[model samples]
Target: MRLPRQREAEVTPLHADAVRALIDAAAPRFRALYLLAASSGLRQGELFGLEVDCVDFLRREVTVRQQLIAPDDGEPYLGEPKTHESYRTVPLTKAVVDALAAHLEQFPADGVKIEDRTDPRKLHHRTARLLFLNQRREVGRRGAWSQVWGRSRRIANKALAATYDKAHAAWVRNGRTEGREPARVEVPDGASLHGMRHFYASLLIKHRENVKTVQKRLGHAKPSITLDTYTHLWPDEEDTTRAAVEAVLGDVPPLCPAKSA
Candidate 1:
């Protein structure tokens, strides 16, 4: 049966500066969480599920074996990763590693009771040192975490807007008439915790990372999924083609000699 094609939604990743602002504006308790989100391409659930043992400090990597699943009617529990590909070891940048180290020092890991649902046949209870916890020192619930993210986003947006206003005022006072006025910067309302994941993807793309590498980092099952989401972020083939041809032919002499003019 034929159906109307829906328009692909545009993905506007958080700008690098905005990401910094967001992290800066986030509560001290969650600063590392936001930084990790932007640095590692882990999903919210994976971040929620992280345990002290998941991180390998010497290796500079985090193992993704499980995720925190929050059900509507019941409590959050530990479950298998979304897919097999999701169970990967994601490398960490030095900056992220330092941030994590500082965070651990500031907020010591607490042993929390985790309900394990990884084995569907039987549920198990275990105490593990979770990486992040709410104010009550409990495993963070998705809803509460999202609310905190929303508050941080609003605070960051206001700070950005104020900075833009101050710059615009200065420009007007200086009577600068050179180029078009810079566009005002504001983190979009649509930006959410997931936007940090998109920001991470953009970072990989900016560094000219290959499709397969980006796919692996993001834990996508296939390269096609990565390309489908971020194809536009890649450099245009036309530009590369032109540059290649120019490099080869730019200094060559004309084949035919011209007559005296």
Candidate 2:
């Protein structure tokens, strides 16, 4: 008997405006984290695993040296990135660099002793100056991070809803009630922290960045994987074909025009 094929994962990236709102609404300590995630496309684990040394302010880049791995029965620890390609350097936009700088100024980095398991053969212990830490000033765990993200999402949604309410009121005051009431504004349902990574990929595609470049920036194992996931976001082939033909041959009159009624 043949097994059924699995459905592809849905890709619903946040719009630019929504990203801005979320970043603005995020808690001060985590605001830069959100911006970096959206800008760099680093996986959640990679973001958590960042150390002070991983970010180069002068070069405006963040190197992916390790990731935070949380096992079923133990605490989270530093480990190697998911794949060889994941160990790459991602460039940062000026805005992201500024935000990171401000974050560091507000909340200074602190050294923490954590287990390093980047190599499976040998586990090492080291004191790392982590870029981000939990409220307790220790290494952040997945569960705590998720909770904070959820709280931030809720705050953002409420702020968006309030803005919509204000706009609707203005529309009513302007005597423009010709149609049904506009629905409340909220971030897409089921939009999680991972959506920021998707947003980053969408931004790269929008800027006409080539597939190979996108793959490298996102640390995808292969170009095919990037294509498989983001093929739809690219310019439509049919539209490109028409544009190419139009460029070669100026607008041609229809071969057979319908007779005037």
Candidate 3:
């Protein structure tokens, strides 16, 4: 039996506003992490593996040299980038940089101990100034962080839905269904933590960035991968060309003559 190949992962950028709302909904310790992920497009593990030095305020860049990984039997541990391209650096947004700066001042890193996932018996002690620490003053665990993010995500989505309902209340009261009032703007419940990376890609595509630029910014292994993932987001250039031709030369006769000519 020939089975159909599964499609690539679905991309739905939850967007910056929703990202900010989620950050706001999270506890103070997690605010910097959320902002960094949204702004820099870091994977959850990359964000988790961040050391204080990963950020360069003067250069306005953040490096993705490492990531945290958890195994089925062992504790979570930091490891090198999964791919060579994943070690690239990315520019950081001012808001995110500032938020991180503030976060560092408020919460300093105290070396957290974790069992290396590579070898359960071999424990690794992290001396780097990790950006995030839970209430126990240790690096975030995958299980615990997942639960935290799930809770905060719901809170942020509910808040957004409430705000949308209030804004459209008048229209609903009058039973109007047209215009922006009818538009639905609720947060995406389907989005996972990696959606922040997709959200960043969406913004870059919307701003008309080139494939190479997107690939580099996203740390994609190849331009083809980036294009394949985001080709749907690109505007229809062919349609635009047709429209341009129509606007400028619609009144003119066809360049081709009759069949006899």
Cα lDDT, model 2, residue 238? 48
What does candidate 3's lDDT look like per residue over 89-195, in tens digits?
99987888888889888897656665443334655664666777777887667778778888888888888777778768977777776465645544576666787
User: Across residues 174-214, which tens digit of lDDT does each residue of candidate 2 receive?
Assistant: 78865766567567767877889999999999889999999
Please name the candidate that would achieve the greatest TM-score relative to the true structure. 1
Candidate 2 C-alpha error for residue 28, in Å: 1.5
Provide the lDDT at 189 for model 2. Answer: 69
Better of 1 and 3 by lDDT: 1
In candidate 2 the C-alpha lDDT for residue 12 amounts to 62
Candidate 1 lDDT over residue span 193-259, tens digit each: 8899999999999899999999999999999989889988987655587788889998987689777
Number of the top lDDT candidate: 1
Instruction: Rank candidates, TM-score, best first.
Output: 1, 2, 3
**Model 1 misplacement above 4 A:** 177-180, 239-261
Which residue runs of candidate 2 sit more than 4 Å off their true CA positions? 1-4, 177-184, 237-261
C-alpha root-mean-square deviation, each candidate: 4.7, 5.4, 4.6
What TM-score, computed on C-alpha atoms, does each candidate reach? 0.87, 0.85, 0.82
